[model samples]
Target: MTTDADDVRSFDQRGGAAQPKALSAIRTIARREIAEQLSSARFLIIALLVVGLTPLAVYVGARDYKSRLEDYNRLVAEQQKMIAGPAGREVKGFDVGWSEGNDLAVLRAIRPPEPVSALVRGLDGALPQYWDFSPTGIVTGPLASRPQRIADVVGHLDMAFLMRVALGLLAILLAFDAVAGEKELGTLRAVLSQPISRAALLTGKLAGGAVTLLLPLAAAFLIALISAQLFGVDLIAAGALAKVVMLALTAGAYLVCFYALGLFVSSLVSSQKTSLVVLLVVWVVAVLAVPPIATMVAQAASPVPTSQYLETRKDALDLDIRRQAELEMGGVYREITGDPEGNADTDKYYKNKESIDRRIVPIEVGYLNRRRQILNEIDRDAERRAANQNRFASLLMAISPAAAFAGAATDLAGTGDAQYAAWLESVRRYQDSLNAALFDDPPTVMIRNRGASFPAELRKPPTVADLPSFAPPRRDAAAVLSRSLPAIGLLGLFTGVFIIGGFFAFSRYDVR
Candidate 1:
């Protein structure tokens, strides 16, 4: 009994879903967003500059990597020559042929490895290269040396300059016109009057804006890759490529976060100009003004003294000579194989030896222990101060998207302060290994003039080549990733909140 008109009416009612229906509509909006920026002369100029300079920077970084590799090779050759030369004479008079008067025992106790092991691509290296002198982290033992200069260059081009500056700028530019510009053009009320839901309208705009902002980053990454390859740096490792992809994604997340932040401020404020000013101020305080100040504060709170000062302090407190008398008595007993009273006849020589041993052993142990203690104290103080800085930096990350981006990007690059501190820990472990090698025996050898009939070979300590090189404790990349999760969580959380807020705010906005 239903009429044709009723059937048509029911279909029409079903079609009223409170959203944009066609894929074409979303594409149209996204296209508009990108086109708007492409038409801007200022943005065009900036994009061009970023494109042109990225390649140049990569080339310079590659050249620097090459130079360092050459230097490491030269250092290795020099070390080999030194080991074979006349200067590498052995010491005598000690239990192990080491002389007591010479610190050659200490020198031979911790022989440095050939510098070639530290270089990337030295005389044609391979992948998974480990960098030397990385205060953040370094691989220990013999490993492949691939030039990480590509990582550095790509990181610099894509993350530091782009996310912190370029994309941030673009976000501000897009947001400046988000609401006010529409109102100024007298089309705000017209757009709001449509039957479309407010949230849908806002979602469309934000989607559009994000597309515009992220395109440049994508372009930059592509161009940077091509340019790096030209400079003899191949960052084509799976990990490296994965890292780059994550960086781009991170950049996009940052763009949306900042754009949302700017839009929120813009909506709350009365004028576009004021909103732009506020954003610029926030950017400067969070990105340009904060990290360096934090570093300075940390350094001041926990100072790092020079090695010479530590050495001088150690030398001035010579406990060796002070305990010499007891050592001499002890030595006499050992030589005579009896108590001090039983060796009374030889007490003079025994006492003298005992005194020297007492003076030397205690002073050396004390010096080493005290220095180690002082260094530990300094390091703890530094860590404490860094903790304070980290807290403040975390706060900045919450308030400013630029800070979040910087934190994420640097964390990815393994260039942040935390990573650097971890690297220091590895080096300290290596030093401990060196200490163990030195103290394995009497740990002290005395150098002496050759016996009248002995050859020159009998007068010197063992060759430096005989000693073992220091090896740092190994690090797990997964562990590093786990440690960084909190920062990542913070950034990811911020992005999520902004995304939700952006859609909500845009939907509810009074366009009129």
Candidate 2:
């Protein structure tokens, strides 16, 4: 029986056909598929599920973001005061270097939480918020945030949550029946009996379903962005909007990939029930099983120090620094005056005050050199180990697209490794400047030059006004895009491959 689809196909198959006809056929199928999906109970239930869950994620994220923002501002303010010398002016007892537990240096390495993290929070929330920067440094801070529950560890309600969990499953559910379901009911064969090409039909169905899925997401996304503003997130960072757009695009691509996978599976299978079951299993493995397995593999492959261990080791190193400083200081006194018990007893040392005084300056100089050498080695080793662990983790996640997206998304949002590097580099430079300023102006040496005694007060109380202010480096859109550009390209390539595979599979599908 000749039908309208058949007539359209006949017209196109003959000389009347053109690119427009092909596109029209594709669109015709797309429109019908879109209508069918929109009217289905499945679509309604999934859309409602998305709407119901998204707000909780937003609320929690917003609250966390606001608190962090406030913390960052206050931290910077307090550091500024210390640098200006108002806060640390009357610090108790004698001044010592940062390596010896002296809080003299106001240099702090900080990668503040990204404001947009409220919508798409990633690994940054779990990374160290701040670390003390010193010339001979022992930095101690949290590696990541501690989650209160299993849900916090498994997943949060941010955009990444939706991208990885909700939309991923939704795509599969929507498409698992796209071809096999129709074939089971004889609709696929009837549609194929028309003149329309199989490839065209598949293309239309996939495109139409993609649009239908995206429609609800687009609305939800708009609402989330609007909520971001109302939640008082800082949106003025360079390329903030650009980063959000990139992440949104990533989520869209991720969603479409799953949809295409579902279609591919449907085309391969004969029964819709079988297709759905197969796709669901695949979904569970891809989204759930792989990432954690990858993480465990990474942990075993490249063991990392626990935060407590790091903190404890740093404290031990600090104690060693103190002990070494005193030992060297005393060694210099004995070497100069032939007194092994030099300065151990202040009253006895005062018995030969001039002798002790004469050696004090040189003793301090020797002690500093010894302390700096030891601590530099410790710092270098710690950093190398941490870097190796981070690299290992990055490599293991290559197979897991969700992790890839989260890492890339976090980087784009200024809460990933890039920000950490930027923060570290900024503080390192500041520390260098501080060290230069400190060495150039030895307060005690200046006092001694003026014929003063040891431990003399500084003429200026060591104002940080002379030191250069540290501006935490922020990655612009271009830099962020460049860093994750390779990942983005790879993801797109994968999606394209899946799409092409779907087309080829459908072309060979048996309508019988």
Candidate 3:
């Protein structure tokens, strides 16, 4: 019984000619395996599934992006109009007049939809697309559009979803019977008796099967890009194109993880049926069960307060501060006018206006400062808790290669939590800028005089250009790649573990 090692050593003794022969053997086996997989009914079915579903997913995602973009544009226009007044000339039809009391009225900042979300809609759909800033506090706006209830159940049809679910299953199907079925048919013994080493045989099978599995995926990717273009999604720009390429590479790595896992299972089992059943169960657990269960566990373990609760608390705080300020101002008014009811005669009121304001303005400024500090504290606490919960969920979900792939894909596509967080930080900066522009100086109470009721400085409306505009932060490719590294590393780790396991298991596999 000459082993493959003995055959290899004998060939090595023949003047180093064995290297080329072994390479030829591996190539031959790879080609044969590829032909077999391409001719199989299962391959055809899976190919059709990829080709048919990818474009549909792209279409749905593109339509959603368009709708959100429209909403974003409309909101931005409204915000600009509200700030600059009608026709940018006069303050006609404006809700808030240019008065001291109404200086810090509601201001808004809108986040535009990411163009790459036409392929992967991650936290983009879930996170608020706008924020409102006011004297009281910042408020998160509602989602640009509500997702269908069915989408909550079935999930969004996007490239990430298809790669995680459909392509993962295809990888499993293609590799589940690679070694076990050959053994069952007694073909493994005949192949092992040939001049090829076991390592070469395994390498050939892996190469051949990967090619078979990835060809359909490539075609599906092409179709998806084409569909995105047809629907007016701009994925061809240099930055977006780079992200798309990264996404494609991430998908390839994810599928390879499943393929290697299936091959390892096939080598470990004695029968093809047993191998397939085992791989199917693993696939279900990894793809369908792990991500949601991780989320549930994370939520249960690290609960955060709801947005409504925080909003209510801030509202209550604002009311308390306002009531306190009013009481103090009333006391000041009585002291200045020597009227217990603070109802001084018009002549007396006009005469003491300056004196009363000097006493009352400090009270108003102090209360305003107190209110902002308390509200900002509450917001920081909420954000910290939410961040902790997200980190925990991400750690748990990393157990599933599918989830890892989704994370990487979404991050690259600029639709992930990282991108959303960046958007939020930008909005906060804009909020701060707006506050400085409107309230840097303490506004003085203006008494109605015989000539003008409003301040002479505010006679003309301020144009939109007068205010600080929001400049959305753009993440360069390097920054996005850095953010995606953790998930990408997890995927690579999964692929390595499965490939090593398959090689080790197949080395001892019995074909008798």
Candidate 4:
């Protein structure tokens, strides 16, 4: 009994000789907290839920994208058939009544490029270098084509919906209880009583909590990769992988900021219940309230209507084309002959007038072109201003945890407003192409006024190969990285401030 007593005394002496360092104490506290969290049933449930639901969401999104892609292909084929019929041989709605010599001359004037379908499909950035001719020898435009429809669908859901809603919600769930829950349990007093500095304790806790949260995030990344492969997505380069990693890091930063906010709330409130209530309220405002409100404000301020409105306007404009054609022919004839008044020499004047009208065909084409430009400009400006509103809202909400998640998640998913901006850019490029094709060399029209032989002047129709092709815009990785820096920096600063403040608050805390 005496020997055992002596051994206990010796061990106590050794322990006293080497007192726990401040960092060591803080680390021990953090370790204990981490262990406590892992042992709790809540952590297990969250992990299970994330792992289980992620696959289902990815699978559904991929399947839908694939379905749309197939439908678009069929639509393109049907459009090609419609464009290839008798209408294909007509030049701007003018029927060809060519004499044998004129027919041969018209056929030679415009021959289809070899393999014209490739250019029409939008696979090539411009018209194909070659085309193929039909047996009838009628020149036709490239087959109606567009990028695989699946590309748009996958781009929408993969980058936007998944990143914004999924990872963001997960980050919030992980962080909400981080500091506040500690105050709920009675052990917070014991933790603060240690000799360690408040800063060291806060740092240790943050590091430990991060490790716990990141494990599942890593799993989510693996799932995303698998989903991408399963859906036959061209897993080119490491772009997708990098995006996923960046998204996870952004989510982690958002949660870290929230964790610090929760700690601050906990420090101010004596009770955990009040801290939780405050945290939830903040979530509601930031996540649920702010985004939609921002969208509404943007729409009201910029006045960009839905796609339905644009479609209706387009239909109306199409209906007035015949009237526009008449105006164009009349205006061109007046401009060319320099005669505003009617002439009495019907036979001679009419024959000469047809040639003059043909020369000024470009004027009519220009009028049609300008009208389209005005509508496009309106749509573009409205969308640009609305996007600016959304960006402003994101910056303002960086102060709140909920807003942080929304911004960060969207950045990660690559589906945020930036995606629409890319589409706009593509449309602009397409417009430039249209200008090059049509306006650069406007067509001349020879009117046949008398019921007789073909008009003395001949005109050729524009070829489909001459039409512009659309190229979709892709985001610059560097640009996205730069945009994200502000959010990350602000969150980091907020987290540091809360951690330091919480440490000091706990240091002065009374432990009776």
Candidate 5:
């Protein structure tokens, strides 16, 4: 304690009392804080934990990414090969026509996992990695389901976890006693006799605390990033350096938020023990409690209809349309072919029925149109309810800087919920294009006697090389930064508000 006081006093004496500057005092305090943080055993422990755990996480995640990419390539290759196999290839007696080959929708809309996921696995669970498509339509596989259990609590060891949870706790450790600890040990009174102002003291602690917290995390992140490249991830080589830069800045903001909160609590409490307790309580509420509680409240307030409800309604409507279409098409086929009572022969009767089914497929489009409209209504309703629920969560964002920072980092990294929405829309558009290519024309059916419907001579299906390629949309840095501006603003506001509060509390704080 006396050494800390002497450290500050000696700096003031070196400059002489006649030239006691706030800048000098603040710098002195900041340097001293940095020295102490580096020398502490806790700093070594924190450093080892981050550096040790992060590369292992990256290595594991990178292996999974590599595995999934190989699967995607292999599946795509097999699909292309099968489509080029044979014309009139029989699948359950349905002739694979030239046009049918052109409409081969065998490829799954599977996006390879992003390499940056090693750093930030944001919203990856909520977004599907796979989707299946056939000529009729495409179906998105369900998002991964995680069992809610205590073992699943600290789920992944990505950079998000390191920053939001681990670094947050580390920040508190560095800051919980920034002011109160000094005061308790008889250093505060001696230090205040120097040129330092309360505002300068606060500023020094904030700056030094932030630097101290970020150094280890940044070093560990860079090391793990290189380790990932050794395992063939190559995130930086893949032009993700920009994303990594933004992620680091955003993560730094989160660490600073927690550090400032600790400083604010330390300033308000008179004792180090009391300050530590209050900071811990605030940390628990902000980190653990707010998110889940907000989610439950939002869900209750603005309920979205279940997926089963939508599917059931869609199926029932489709069945009704099919039944109506059959009745209408039966009448039309008779008028065109004049086969009424001409079905006297059993062979004629079967031919007439086949003819009706051929025409009915086209007529069914009208009913499918109606079904799409109803399903669209269901979709729009659900989207509206979800938007409302998001607004409610935003209210919680106002009070939780941790939430704000997490959101901003994820969005900027292109791994947030917004990114997930964008990916979904892209797939939907691709599906619409695929549907148009397959179903826009009238259905062509084969007669029972028309042996060898498509020539067995044409060995392969028509080339689908002209089809548009599905390029997954890329997230632009400028656009992402714009979207995340609000969250960044909140982080800034929280830091400023807490630091200002700390200044006020420390201005009149008893030093003796």
Candidate 6:
């Protein structure tokens, strides 16, 4: 009366002779599972859902990317034209004078849509598209002409979304009945009557079900890539293709994790219906609920100031600094003109204009520099807080395989938060260059008859060609892979944990 465990031990002891038999048993079981899945109505329906929705999602995403690209080009052209000043006319360049009324020279750094956004939208639309630079600091806002619609708020359907929601659900459906349903049908008892080990049986089921789930996904993914390329996305580029491959691998791991989880649940439960119910609840929680709930929790835990609050604080600081400068300049004016009220004779003011500017320019420059320092501090503080909040949210969301896969997919596509941060860093570098070109040379300020004026030489602004232009930073495949590796590793860990759990639970599962 040898138990199944004794049989497994004996089979292992048989060594070389038993190895081929075990492999053949696993292969046979896998083939049987694959045949059963392919003929099932539920599998066909889900496969059809994925195959049909993939093209539609890609088409919609491509069209949206085209619109954003068009808007980006138009804004960039306008920015260049403005920087060049009015054509065919003699234009006064920036008035680099210490006058509160004079506007600072402003430049715009616009971010173009990532080409791979057609497959994975990530933060492309939500992130700031353009940043306006001034001597004061950077100001960020969306294009006023293109307001965010409901669709943008809800999010666009892309390959990542389809993988997380549709394919993930499909994976669960494929494996939810893998073990328990066989037990209920009395097929498990018949299969276990053979010399096949439980480990081999589970492996066969996992491999076959994975194939059944992944075939439609792989086909649909290829079709989506082709559709994106046809719509003018440059997926054929070496770097882009590599990222696409990484994205595909991420999607596969994500789906397999769900399948493994289903298999684990099926083994743990005695009834197929109970296993499915439990798996569906887990899917809803992991896929539909976790990421957003984690974000909200992180936000509440690590509170950060809003952009509007930061902007208001900066504006108040600017006004206070400006008022302080005005008071200091008033005293200088009173001293120069020998008037308590600070009213100066037009003739005397002009006569002493050079001396007045020599005295007052330094005072104005000091205040301006002080304001820049304080505003920069505010911006840096806000950025730090935001980064902390984001990092915490990411850690919490990584608990879900769906979120992990999405993070990896978006990073590979160059449409994730990391890429957006890189764009912002480039904008900051441009701001620094602009500051060096313009603000580093302190302009003299002359107060005459209650008006501030600059020297004739200062009226001619720096050459447009000499000014720095915004060039978006590009991340190579290596950098993207580095960013995506953590998420990929997490997905792999999830798959391994669930598969191990399934193996352990199925070993003790009652087949009688």
The TM-scores of all predictions, comma-separated, are 0.66, 0.82, 0.85, 0.67, 0.81, 0.85
Model 5, position 134, has a per-residue lDDT of: 39
Candidate 3 ranges beyond 4 A from true positions: 1-20, 79-107, 337-352, 432-471
**Residue pairs with clashing backbones, model 4:** 113-130, 113-131, 113-132, 114-130, 114-131, 115-131, 141-464
Candidate 5 lands at a TM-score of 0.81
Model 1's alpha-carbon lDDT is: 0.52
Model 6, stretches more than 4 Å misplaced? 1-19, 79-107, 141-148, 337-352, 429-438, 442-471
Clashes, model 4: 7
lDDT by residue (1-512, candidate 2, tens digit) is 89999999899789683544768989999999899989888788887777666666777788888877777787778777675665254321123432233545365555577777888776667666676544344354554445547766667778777767877888888999999999999999888877888888989988898898887677666666777777776454546777877777777887787888889999988999999999999888778887787777777887777757755775686577657656765665576546766443444445655655555545454444444556656565666776787777667766666666667677776666756666666766665665566533344431121122234333354545454556777567777777777567667776787788888888888889
Candidate 1 lDDT over residue span 337-448, tens digit each: 4554423333333444554344434443443345445544544555565567666646544555566666665545444444545545655564455444433232342211
* Predicted structure 6: clash tally: 0
How well is each residue in 347-371 modelled by candidate 3, as lDDT tens digits?
Answer: 6656876675566656655665677
Candidates' C-alpha lDDT: 0.52, 0.69, 0.78, 0.50, 0.68, 0.78
Q: Please give the distance, in angstroms, between residue 334's alpha carbon in candidate 3 and its true position after superposition.
A: 2.8
Residue pairs clashing in model 5 are none
Model 5, 1-512: lDDT tens digits are: 56978977886788646554778777888888989988888788877788788888777667656765666576667656654654113211122222334334344566656667667767654466566543334456545323325525756667777778777888888898899999998788888877667888888888888888889878977887798789897777535677777878888878888888888888888899999999888888887778778878888887777888868876787678756765665466556557562222344435555554455445655554455555556666776787788878778656887788778878777777667767767776775664564333323332221122221111122234434445566676776677678888888999888878888888878877
Q: Whole-model lDDT, candidate 4?
A: 0.50
lDDT (Cα, tens digit) per residue for candidate 6, span 197-300: 99999999998888887898889889988888888777779887888888887888888899999999999999999999999999998888888899899899
lDDT of prediction 6: 0.78
Task: Name the top lDDT candidate.
Answer: 6
Q: Candidate 1: worst 10 consecutive residues by lDDT? A: 113-122
Model 3 RMSD vs true structure: 5.2
* Cα lDDT, model 2, residue 359: 59
Candidate 4 TM-score, true structure as reference: 0.67
